[model samples]
Target: MQDFVAGARSAFLRLASHSASDSARSLWADPSGVRGVLRHRLAGPTSAIAFCVLLGAAALGVGNAAVFLGLAGFVAAQVLIARVLQHLGHRLRPDVGFRVVVVTWPIALGALGAAGWTAVNDYHGEVVSLIGLITAGLVALVEPTGFAIVWAVVAAAAVTTGAAVGGSVTGEALVSTGAIAVGAAFGERLRHVIEAFLGNRRELLEETARIPASRDPFQTAERLLQPLVRWTPVKNPSLVWFTPDGRSVFLAVAGNNLPPHLAAGRELPEARNAYMRRQAEQGPWTSGWTVVDGDEGYTRGVASLGIQAGAYVPLVHEGRLLGLLTAGWSAAGGDHSAMAEYIPALVEVAHAAATALGPGLAELEQRSTASQVVDDVLHGQRYWPVYQPIRRLRDSTLVGFEALTRFDAPVTTQRLFIQAGLVGRLRDLEIATMRAAVMEARHLPEDCWLSANASPGLLVDTDLLASILEPIRQPVIIELSEHEVITDYKPIAAALGRLGPRRSLAVDDAGAGFASLRHILEVRPAHVKLDLGLVQGVATDLTRTALVAGFVRFAHDAEFELVAEGIETQEDLDALTRLGVGLGQGYLLGRPERASAAASNENAPRGGRAMGASRVRSRTARTRSQAGAIAASRTTTPAH
Candidate 1:
């Protein structure tokens, strides 16, 4: 008995479920179902106006108070129903809201039929029939076919029954029923055309809106396939991107139900070969589904994966193919005729995908090219260092040479370093350049010092600095640029100290900003280089002159050498000399040249005299003494 009861309950639930499903399917059968029609912007206002017209007609013609009240109440109910429909339009999905409208709309029309019957019978009035005709026409124009059919049947029956009972105007009742049916058929056709137009328009707008903002090709392809997969019979939508050389392809993204052999990120050499051959033979692959039973490489592979029908659309921009967009169906064997109508839409989506993927692919190609260039440069050691003369301004004697890197490649030196940094090989490149400069510095004159630029992060590593500088015999000055951010300077100071008495720290690009001042106070280097901005117009600009004067005074009091950079004019050079600036480097003094040429004094400044070797030795000793004094003071100062 328990088994029997359980079986009965199960059967009842299944039946109820099937019934609900069937009802829902029937309600949503039309293209723009009841919900879509009612939620349109004009639906509510049109219905309200019709109801008001009916109320006015009844009030003017009908003498029966109860019938007039019934019409007024009906109009009020319609206004309330319009409000509910408006609310549901926003809060509920179209199909779910269709269920609500199906129940409410039919019952409201049935009540109207009843009111019409009462007026015709009791008051001998014909305004009710006219009002019924107007309502029936409105319903046919906007409501679904099934909904219009139900309303037509109810209204015709009401009119026919009234005529038969009154024993008058049977022919008129017949004519009225036929007119409603005709109006319904015409309106349904019009509704189908309108719905199709609106649907296409909305799809186009959505595609246009989403394509521009997308930067990731894989993500954008996935988004483009979503609506297509949901609305069409296609399954397992996937995108395969070609390599930059167009010699290989990989599955970059996929939707659900993808076959194991076609998993994302997997390379497909056979697919790439087949696509290349077809593209060479034909112009481009058009958008359409075809059966996958052929012996071709891609087709056989797809057929083995259980995809009976497939479509491949080439994502082309500027006559170059970047990728392929594909869709497949497992059960569409021997009959894909049903997919013909969707071909145009599929083509539109493929075009949008191509337009969106162009910029992203171009960016990827550029980065790949940049990375390859850096790799070539590093592997081949295709860069060399040139030395620029740093001269004492009063005597125009070469004090030292600053080592700067130059690349043989087309890219600028600064841009090359920046690119290397982006690829996380900045330190490696810096160390390589430093090693090259150290090797070349052996050719320099014995007395002059060598200054080289090093970032703080690299300079702070004592072990690395020792590996490059320990074997060098000449005086070495390691320059730290003030533009670079250094959270702590103690490590750099300690690194220089560990390199023995030959290594001195110099602050580069001083007077550019506040960071330089902080560097001076903290690092207490042996030399300070003035930024070009302060030195370019120092002879004329009072502000610049004042600033250079202050730096000169600070250098005198601090006992460190102040070098003016970029002294282009005689006036600026004279002004720096008058202001007590001891050293300067610029095009006016000497331009950068090969280390061999610079060591031979081939590129020396005009009217300049080289310092005596003894004098150079004495100045180096004094600079070293001052650096030691500054270090001692910093170490002994309290940390207030």
Candidate 2:
């Protein structure tokens, strides 16, 4: 019950903020709306004053009996005092002019005693009347809805006392005054109750009316932006996409049509800040693309005087240039600097458009470019994988050949296909490379293995990883580049999860950039490659020597097998051997070549490992011509 009352009161308060006095349909009309209003307006002071006047008349009309006269006068005087106080306070009575009236029987009776009435006869009756009024007032105040009830009790006591002793003018007035006061209090309470109910009903209607406008964005935007557009003048605007070479490629105009310069083949100023920012940043760049009207002199044939003035923000995603956002002054009277004001809003729209497009935009672009290349140059002119042997360092015998991918006709460059954010797509290209290498290796010694560098994104796709690995029967190690940012490792772990336990995971660079030794621990790779920078001068530099030694210790504890890469000379091999590195790969061993021809020199002696090497070796074995293979083969080892 209390919760219900509190909820009702809260609803009332919420409605009251707009207008508390207005009339409407009753939400809470328990006492009945009309009755509630009447109770509120005339109930309190009216009832109290009327009761006092009636009681006074009754006291006078009676035969001047001392007891009746005294009791009636006392009651009248108390009511009079209460009425006067209520008027002075000027507060809204819930029912009557005065919401509450306190009739103190003890005080009234004591006054009667001073006026010559005594407990010896009328004194006991006077005492009872005084107690009754006191109890009645307290009860009515607590449960205000029962004010009329308690007032009746007080009135009944007065009339009964008057009738019991003797009929007189004083007795009649007491009865009349008591009845009037009870009615007035109930009336005032009723009026307030009606008013509260009506106020709540009106508010509920207003909120329900606004429900539809919030859901429609176009409607919402119109309603929200109308004030800004009217006060300023610019409304919905155009956005443009840029090519990799910073040319305007596409345009999406939301409201107004685009200027001629924004169309394709339009030249943009290289002196602008937007051009400069993109030029300076090799990855992604952004700045405000600004333009003014002809007042700033024939506005690049794109703007007439006071016609177009807006800002465009460059949008580059995943290191590939995406586009620009354009918004302008809705008003015609703005200066060229108005372009500056539109920058923030333009940037916001740029971000929204970029996020909506998703990550495939860059990959789609690169695929388009790759398709263009293939269509123009044919498949034979494209990239091909060259196999380099990873032989046993101790025996100078071949263990496996690491497949290295390189482009043939691009001629100017021969690197991995990851620059256009297409590393994931390269997994398909990697699988193609592996298929060719394995099919070629079928003619070689039966025990020979193959190690190939695969794109890291492939590790997250289990099915893709399976397809890539399924064709190769020999032991295959997929080397991941350390240069790429690996935001998530779980996918890599999951991909490797489906592979054979003998399959190896190798991190190409052991200690460099953000790819610290921690990556080794995180991925728990089977093998780690010492970067060429670290391996180049390990024999000469003590610092490099110490660094490698420390890494070797960590590898041993973690159970990771280490490979010192880029060993160009016997001295490099000798240094790695002393440092307890078992395997080495570099120019001094054998340059990357075609798989079949590269394997023909399997038994030949070399400065490093011989082709087709397979004997396993401990960290202590370094020089070629030992019994075991140079590449360590372990079921599983600790992460680097």
Candidate 3:
């Protein structure tokens, strides 16, 4: 099966990183691990010399040629083991070299011990037993869990050879075996503790230091620094964010270890350009912790604190420097030069943090351009309102008109509202638009009602709304769109009550969902408008027909008028009329137009209704070719 091959291929690829043999070797044969343990043992340079002098002067030090020769050979084997561990590459194969050396080491020690005991039988073979005990300790320190496995072969060869040659179950062999068993018992527990600690550390890094999907950049930076300072040698970590102008660096957050002298969350006077120029000239500078050592900026940064050294990791993504993540340490904490092996992991963490803040930083550059355009539009007052006629389905005569905002510029109503909200100017822009619409109400025929869309939040302003509509002779109906929700309308109901006959509320988009249904019941608006999503295909789509039928029944029971919005087709209009809807508005009834053009439509002849509907149908048929691309591109509205 194709699935089986794909799985096998994936497993083959993973073998490079997760081989059992390599896992064992990395634990036992790591060059640095070997060096650190050997440095404290008799095999090391200083200690080896001391050990040789002491062995020569011991009570059983009477020189035997075979044992002396064997000691030279044994020392040679130890040197070879260290050298091979230090220089092992892929071809030198850690598993192969480790197997050969561990086996050869115990054999050489066993042979030397047996030969020396045969020659003298003095000193009770204590020196050989002591070597076995210490060798077991060295294994426990470096390999931990693997000590028991390796010592099995060692005990068999050493004890069997010593007994077969001359000694008869000497007390020395028992001491050596007991020492090894004790170290191995404790070594396994120590290894498990270390493994548990490492697993937790890795999980924390993955959770806190990965590139977030989207978030507040400073919050992400603060999360990243917590564990960096906790687990790593990072003593005092500070994450900085740049101003839009990039002239200053503001510390967003810092770890608890931050020095008392430098209070965080303030802008630093140091010019970022200078540090950047130095990095450009020097190229890819990392002091293992990702900073250039001895740079002038670094020295100045740590001057007041007790920190003697530091790192300045530039958080960059997609060629933009979001900020800098800096960490430092006092002299007593130790140098960062020993962190060379961990540099790759540190760089990975930096990249992830940088990516989290990158998109938010990109938005900053665009804000200036966008804000400027929005300001020009606001100050220029380039937006105006157009009127669309709403007719009674029974008489085919105009009853009201809705005021829709129109812009001379290229922008969608949805995008306009969204951009205004993002810029924190929606309320102001909406107020300005509403004022323009209210001013046009006086021009409407005295017999007709003026309906204008507004958000639910604006319902709280009874006095302001009444004053804005005071100039109009026509009754004003305020309709809140379906896009917004009203949790409780008690305050809104009270506000409208104060205005009395001057204003009445309408719930826009009744049949869409729960928000509109709740608005219908709570506000008890003068009329409820069915959304185009439910009305557009009611003639053909059974689901929409069922939904509109239910809404009609509810409106009839509540004794409130129902207006169907977006009646684009004759089929749609006929469906609403048959369903007992009293009102309808859309392209089919009349296209939105200025007040002068709107006057001719208000009290039209009964014949004009059929003619206007026919013309709308013809225009729709004609423009389907030109507008098809746009209509197709918009995401499905509803009934998805």
Candidate 4:
């Protein structure tokens, strides 16, 4: 029962909202609707004038002064009501204006009925009552069918009562009541016809305003403009698609008769005249179209191109100015008078063009935004580096720090890189970030080393890599992700080879995919870092423990150091140490921090042995043995 009550309540609220919306639309939204007909046809100053003439005829023919005064009072009251409605039309909000119209409508009808009641006994007075009934039906045209019927019935009752009080026959009262009922029914039918016509027009406009499927802006412009040139008196039509900034045109396409300067692929600085430029920027929905004569000073430039008249239409969608559509006529084509007749049709075509070009314009805007973001990061130097400490798992001593990029903008590091790649500035962004990391590495402790990330493509550019890495005085490892697909590793290997003995290569995210094994065999990196997924649950998961053991065996045989990433728990760290993993990094060891904080040893493990003692005993002995084995293996094997 509670669920049923809740459902009924929701249904009722929806119905109420829908009815209110319908009422607002029918009363004031469309210019050709019932509200417009009431203001212009039935309740304007012309209606006031007609009432005044009727007042004069009543005063001249009637001998009863009281009846004449009552009739005159009705006319004055109706004129005042019409004036008030017209005066407040622009001042009130739509809903408020609708309420005012509804409240005043019945009052005006009541006044007319009173005048009809005042003179129902006389022969000339019958004409007055009949006219009042017709006016009451005309007023009903603006009301809902139910309200119109109720108000008409009340007015008919007043007329009938007055006829009986004046000693008129019963048949006469029935005739007066029947007249009002018939008028109300006729008025309701007329209102529905007008509303139907407006609804059809609105639907037609919506159908024509649909987005085109083409992604190319030029093709979209050409397809939309062809209909305008074919159907109307416009002999020459041109479309100027604007750039995202709205400061310049990226593409301009014109009909055959237009000058060569306005041809396809040409950029236009602005529209022909200041008015056209202003109207285009503000959009057609706000400023409408601007028609210019050939002889005008502002149009002299186009006149020289044999164009006699022109109309500028702005292509706007959802308040964004996408482009401008201009239609022109030559002397042989037509004059301003001939073109004026077809201006409405030209506007319809321009509206259709705006809708069809929405997708292409949106894409251009997004690309422009991405380009700007990349430029700010590269040229403005808005990026910096943070360091996450790497530790020796057995002793918990800080071994090295991996430098990662951070930005001033409120965007993810990966997203910035992706945006840069889209704008063809990926290399520039990578190089800039690497250079910043290398510069900040000067602040690190003398005993600690640094590892920085680089793509295979960036490593292939040996000269660019050398310029960034050569300045660092400490040992540096260029870490490459296993996710990148490298068809040729010779260029990258040669680039690292030229960086001298201080620089070494590290294969990052090992054991994450099959490609990491291929990268290990091909590049023969000095260090292979286990992927986080393998290390996260290595404490209990036998499958993850087995994978770590395999990497540990391979690292020993290949003469490479093994590091486990993302050791978040103490159990995982102990598990990795038991598996013979020598180096690791994660939140359990130290989070990434700036150079000053990271280099101060504040982020080091709380009760671990210092690097000085550990380096002398275990790490140095292992490094010396690995270096010796690496040298011997390289001499026997071919270069990768």
Model 4 regions more than 4 Å off: 1-250, 256-360, 482-485, 511-518, 540-550, 553-559, 606-640
The Cα RMSD in angstroms, rounded to one decimal, for candidate 4 relative to the true structure is 14.4
**Backbone clashes under 3 angstroms, per model:** 0, 66, 0, 0
Q: What TM-score does structure 4 among the candidates reach?
A: 0.53
lDDT of each: 0.62, 0.49, 0.58, 0.61
lDDT of 3 by residue, 1-640 (tens): 1222222222222222334564345423432232222222213531352245236535466455545544565456456544554344234443443333334433434444444445433433545454444444444444445655465446544543443334544533543343334333333443454455456557646865654635455566667777676666655666666556544444444544443333444555454445643453332223322324444444444544455545566677887666666666553333443232233334556677777777765665456445655566579886777788899876778988888766543344565566676777777777777788778656778888988877766767777777766777888888877778577788888988987776898888877778887787788888999987898889899988888888889988998899998776677778888888899987677667677678766876321245555645644742552363244232111100
TM-score of 3: 0.62
RMSD of 1: 16.7
Reference-based TM-score of each model:
0.58, 0.42, 0.62, 0.53
Per-residue lDDT tens digits for candidate 4, residues 1-640, read 1222222222222223234455344334433223343344335432453365366556556556656555566556555665567456545544455446545554454445444454445544554544445544444543447756665665455454555455355434543454444334434444454345344434544544543647777777776665554444465577767665545452544555554446676555345433456667653321122335542333444455667656566777777777777766663433343233233444565678777777876876666777898787677877777787898888878879888766755455556676777778877888887888888878887577888888888777778788888778879888888778888888878888887898899998998898888889988999999998898888899999988898888999999999888766666777888899999986667756778889997444521343333323432333443453334222110001
In model 1, the clashing pairs are none
**Can you write out model 2's per-residue Cα lDDT over 1-640, one digit (the tens) per residue?**
1222223232333224222332122212322222222233223333343344336435545333554455456555545544454443234322222123222322332244234223213434443344335434633653366655656576556644643453445654454444455444444354455366444434433332332333222233223222223322354444444545445443333334545554433445444436534553442222222355432332444443234445455555555456554454433443323243233333443444454432434544555565444333234535455666665566556666677644433312222343223333444455555556556656555576666666666666657666756756677777777776777787787777778676778888887655746568688888888887898778789999998999889889888888777676566677788788867676666656665678676666656444223123212234432222222320110100
Q: Answer with 2 or 3, whichever has the higher lDDT.
A: 3
Q: How much is the lDDT of residue 609 in candidate 2?
A: 42
